[model samples]
Target: MNIIISNASSDPIYTQIMNQIRQSILSGELQAGDSLPSIRQLAKDLQVSVITTKRAYEELEKEQLIDSVVGKGCFVSGANKDFIREQRMKRLEEKLLEVIQDSKELSMSQQDVIEHLTILFEEDQTS
Candidate 1:
């Protein structure tokens, strides 16, 4: 699996790892039963501490997104599209709520907030 971490991002390193792996699985880039790299290998490759990678993997395991077997590496868990969509929608809604809160706190008009979102959505469609 390929993952890109943004060190300067507001998110923590382990969260970045978790999000990227989850996205890959959601996008079908990583299928169920596909083994992930060893935590030590990934840590070395990503230039992050072993604790960070371990925490990320552990969180995924706790979420039932991946499983680990003794003597074997971690593998993606079998997940249905419905489950993925439901989870993704939940995450998106949470982020939308955060943005809405920010807009409200800033005293931005509803129309202006919607316009900004529209532009962002349009750019995403083009890209």
Candidate 2:
């Protein structure tokens, strides 16, 4: 598992960790049954407080993205199809929101935004 912490981000350290891990799991980069580093070890590696990593792990568990075993460490859980679809849609909405904001900032018309999106979608399909 790979995680990068950004000191400059507005989000809390733990939230950053949790979001990356969650994204990895949802994207299939971290498969079901893959063991996660111990909280202490992850804290050390990330050079962050142990409490931060623990909190991230707890939230992940609550979201059902990871399961904690008594002696064994946390492992990625099998994702439900519906849950995965929901995650994908949420990510799409976030990206679309950003695109809309950028378009507005650029003073682009609605038709311009739609044309750009259509081109991008077709390009993605061809690739």
Candidate 3:
């Protein structure tokens, strides 16, 4: 898996790592039981602190997206499809909440938000 870190991003390093890995899993690019790099190795490769990588792995574990085996490396969890779908829905809801908050702060109407979402969704489908 290719993980990119951006100093320009508002998100922290671990968050970026976690997001990329999560995207990979959700997109079926990373299969269940697929091995991930060791925490220390990934840190070295990414040129970040081992603590950062460990924290990312821990967060992923908490989300049930990956599992670590004693004396072995981490692997993608064999999570059920329903669980994965629920997780994805939760993420989408969180993002929508953020958008709603932003729109409210800008004094945008609900109808405007719905229209923007419809346009964006249709554009994505066409692409």
Candidate 4:
């Protein structure tokens, strides 16, 4: 559970925590059955309010990313990796749709945008 909170971001603290944990789980960094720190301990470690950590944990549970077992603390949920990957890709497509719309509004042709994306993709692949 390596989380670095960005206090300067517009996102709320709890949302920052939830998003990072979810990403970690989806990326296989936090595997199923991995134990998460207790809420109190995490709060102290992150130097955030207990309520903030609690809310983040609660949201993660709701998203089925983590499960709380009585007397055992919280553990990463047994979510299928394929499903998580699909879900993440779908979310990314939605965001890309918004960016595509903005690109059109800025008078950039689709081909231009795609060419730029291709360059970026190639760079990423090389790296």
User: Sorted by TM-score, highest first, which candidate order results?
Assistant: 3, 1, 4, 2
TM-score of each: 0.78, 0.67, 0.80, 0.73
Q: Candidate 2: lDDT over CA atoms?
A: 0.91
Better of 2 and 4 by TM-score: 4
Ranking by lDDT: 3, 2, 4, 1
Best by TM-score: 3
Better of 1 and 3 by TM-score: 3
Error of 3 at 101 (Å): 5.6
Candidate 4 lDDT over residue span 18-127, tens digit each: 99999888888988999999999999999999999999999989777899998889999997778767776898999999989999899999999999999999998997
Q: Tell me the spans in candidate 3 whose CA falls farther than 4 Å from its real position.
A: 94-107, 115-127
Candidate-wise lDDT, in order = 0.90, 0.91, 0.95, 0.91
Clashing pairs in 4: none
Q: What is the lDDT of residue 51 in candidate 2?
A: 99
RMSD (Cα, Å) for all candidates, in order, is 2.6, 5.3, 3.2, 3.4
Worst 10 residues of 1 by lDDT: 79-88
Q: Give me candidate 4's TM-score against the actual structure.
A: 0.73
- Runs with alpha carbons beyond 4 Å of true place in candidate 2: 87-127
Model 3: per-residue Cα lDDT over 99-120, one tens digit each = 9999999999999999999999
Q: Please identify which of the two predictions, 2 or 3, would achieve the higher lDDT against the true structure.
A: 3
